[model samples]
Target: MAQIATAAPGWNRFVGVSRPIAAAILGLLALLMAWGATSDVGRDHVRVATSSSPHFDGLVGDHALYARIAQRVAAGESYYTTAAAEHRAGDYPLRPFVAVRLPTLAHIVAALGEKKAQLILLLIGGAAISAWYRRLRTEPDLPRAAAIGALFVAANLTQLAAREWIFIHEVAAGVLIALALALYRPARPWAAMAIVAAAVAIRETVLPVAMLFGLFALIDRDWRAAAGWLAIGLGFAAGLAAHVAALAAVTTPADAASQGWNGQGGWIAYLSFVQASSLLRFFAGWVGALLVPLALLGWAAWRSRLGLAALSIQLGYAMLLMMFARPANFYWAMLVTPTLFIGLVFAPAALAELARSLRGENAPNRATAV
Candidate 1:
């Protein structure tokens, strides 16, 4: 009997029960919080924003690479030629549908020119932030927690604009994701659906978030919403499949570098980003640190369905980063930074609530007078 009493709590479970599940969630959350704090997001933000004329003239690293890519498109070059030039030093392929990226931003930049495109994106981002902010005046029953999400997203984007991380599709996707969540309502489901679908086009990483919305809708027994999201996911998947087929049809150049471009890396590459000299400076982005907590905290916050979806996107990206997110590929995370910081902004409250629930589940309760 004493041994039984001494046995760990929750050890008597038979089916549909396990202590490891809770432990895993807690562990991941802790790691994310710790890393997000120490990864120097603030430092990186300052550095990027303070860089001299080199950055202004588009003579830096990936910023320059992307700028040059846009210039080539503006000059009427094909995707292959533009991407090929920067990647010649690396083994990256010059294929049409290279996982390196999609052509959404390039197309926009080509049409508008980089400076003009920058101004346009800044305006659109401002409008999105304003739209969500205006909801505070209108949404009466809305909880303060919801407003946290709105402010978080708006602030992150504003920082991006201030720092000139303009027009990256991921930033656009993040804006759309926030807008979708803020405006997601039973009265006007179509608007939310359209925004989320547009995010899928901007960055496929957002597709799972769309699917998670479907799952949440199913749980809420909103079959129409579930069906709409399911259809969106299907269409997004079909588009990706077509892109892959096109990539296969256009063979990589014989002279193209091929060091580790095709989905390569493991624990070594994952941990390498932590080293001072590591080429893949994850914190180079203004909000890289926030990605960790945003993913973890949002996942644990049961009250926020979109938070959970943001967590899913973060986890998916984490796995991809572990495998394929090399130093050169850090730009991948750029697409998701908006959502990451937004999630990070609301993490403290979500974490406190999560802590209370976990303590309630684990602590031995006594019948004390309340």
Candidate 2:
């Protein structure tokens, strides 16, 4: 009996030592599942003799356009003139066109080809997971909880959206946005601004998130942070103006309408559609089983002031989408998912408290914690 007890201690030590390895393995498995889903969609695009599926044809088309731009550039055509002229002539939406305008990434894709671009995007997805993990490490109060949070965020349906829609700039933009927000309190304003700029360049919808961050900075009386956010906003506005000017120089007013600028009203309506679609796709299609528990935790987290602010911003963004965009797609709400998941990080603790209360040990204290 003594020998058996001694052996059990060694077994326990092995299990403890292997915990991290197990977690890492699980995390990798989750990522593999996400990658499989993205590859499935990519393969479908190939099967259809297109670069995208029906659900995300916009992204595919954007990639194809980028490829064409790359090809033209490789053939000694001027990028700004040829690509800009083609963009003015095409029916591409403003957001996607702006994303494709990333000169550096565009050149790389042009040099390497679409398959290589897809591989790079996959790496970016992994980088996002690493960023989240880093963010958790910085939060001393949340260190132990960070692993679970990272896993959840990394494997969530939203991350899948990032992978599947690789052609769109939003995936990279979203990661930047999250990293910026995560670093904001660590006196990393410049880093944060860089991310905000990238997100704005990808999609104008990031403006709301920037505004929310600015509001938080203002409330905290952090003038530099507030100023940084203001600069980001101004930069976005300037970019938008430049895009509009370029469009005007190359295309007629009728062409603008065909390109999805049927006045601000139509834009508003389309944004709303995108927001609604995002919610349905998240809840009903991807991550369906985990939604309820996470949502409950998010609600609980909103009791904190910062948490409430985040929730409010998320809701406001959703409303903005409803008001301004038409043909709303689910992925448009991708930015809101991280904030939602951050709030939901408290859910596991809540569950533990509930379990403790049910066992009739320190029930009152545990209930209060919940």
Candidate 3:
């Protein structure tokens, strides 16, 4: 909310806001950024292991870890065996399968090979961005700034996917979420549900998002959408239950490792970047920490109908982080912030529209605004 401008058409064409309100949100964002940069809620993690558990080996840069898992799976070892050993080596929790990663990425990469698997994922990401662009074009008008922002978002996504974010499944989840948003038409309920199911498989954390989406659709009285998503949610919940039950059955009491934390730190633990063993990773963590408030603001000001689902997922994940944050958990922000960047860069205009409504100005009416 730095300034008022909406230069796009269709979904985001109404971003103009008053300068004073824009300034206020920006000021708040800046203060939060400053607080994050200065605070050290878990600085002790920089000097020593913050976990109280004797077995906690600290965070493994999961890129290499995942690659190793794929290699092991390719070598014909059972996933549970390889995963258990890896977790034991890293001192990650095993009881109730807290640290065991979902098998989607590993299984896919093992069967398809790294290059080919990533290529398919990249294609899916591109398709999702293209779908959003097409939806924007059908709006009958386009703002220059909004158009530019759209292009910027797409380009940033491409660059991010080609880099570290692509190594993670959540990157695909972001793009799939975008695709789900683009395809959420009354006539295309099945298509949207399919995309969401794929996304949840890629990253199970998105299960809550699917549930919230159905809840929103129900509120809208869109029976088809609500029913379709509800069907997918039930299916996903059942699959997750089966998977967890299988893991639990396999693990004995000895495999149940203690999950520990730095009792001293609360949510502010995100600032203690230096605690991370890798200099580059810690730097990325700091940047992600700083972006959190701005992302929250942008998510708040977003005006798309799909913004309801996006915000629900974004806020839900943020609350989960707030409730569970530790020194290592600071990096989780980075995992979730890529798609959130789409909202952050084009936020000013949406803030303006929201402000206008508050001030009894000519606020945007969805049917005629674009």
Candidate order by lDDT, decreasing, is 3, 1, 2
How much lDDT does candidate 3 score? 0.59
True-structure Cα RMSD, model 1: 9.1
- Show where candidate 3 strays beyond 4 Å: 1-34, 37-60, 136-142, 151-167, 258-292, 350-370
Top model number, lDDT: 3
The model with the greatest TM-score is 3
lDDT of 1: 0.54
Tens digits of per-residue lDDT for model 2, 1-370: 1221122111111122233443543354345335433332211111111322232324454545555666677677766665665554454433334423544445555677667766765665566567667765444333244345556556542443443354445555566565555555524567666777777776676787778778878887889888988988888778777765654454444433323422232222322233232333333223432342344344343233334455566557546544433332334545655445654555444433334434444422111110
How many residue pairs clash in all the candidates, one count each?
Answer: 4, 19, 11
C-alpha local distance difference test of each model: 0.54, 0.49, 0.59
Deviation (Å) of 260 in candidate 3? 5.8
Q: What is candidate 1's lDDT per residue for 1-370, written digit by digit as tens?
A: 1222222222121112234654565677667556655544333222221212244264565455566677778899875456655555433445445444666667777888767776766776666666666653244422333445455455556534432355455666766776676566654578889988887886777776677777778888888888898899888878778766654454455644335544454423333332211112434432434344443554344333444555666666657766765555544554444445444433443444345445554434222111
* TM-score (all chains, Cα) for each model: 0.63, 0.60, 0.72
Report the poorest 10 consecutive residues by lDDT, candidate 2: 5-14
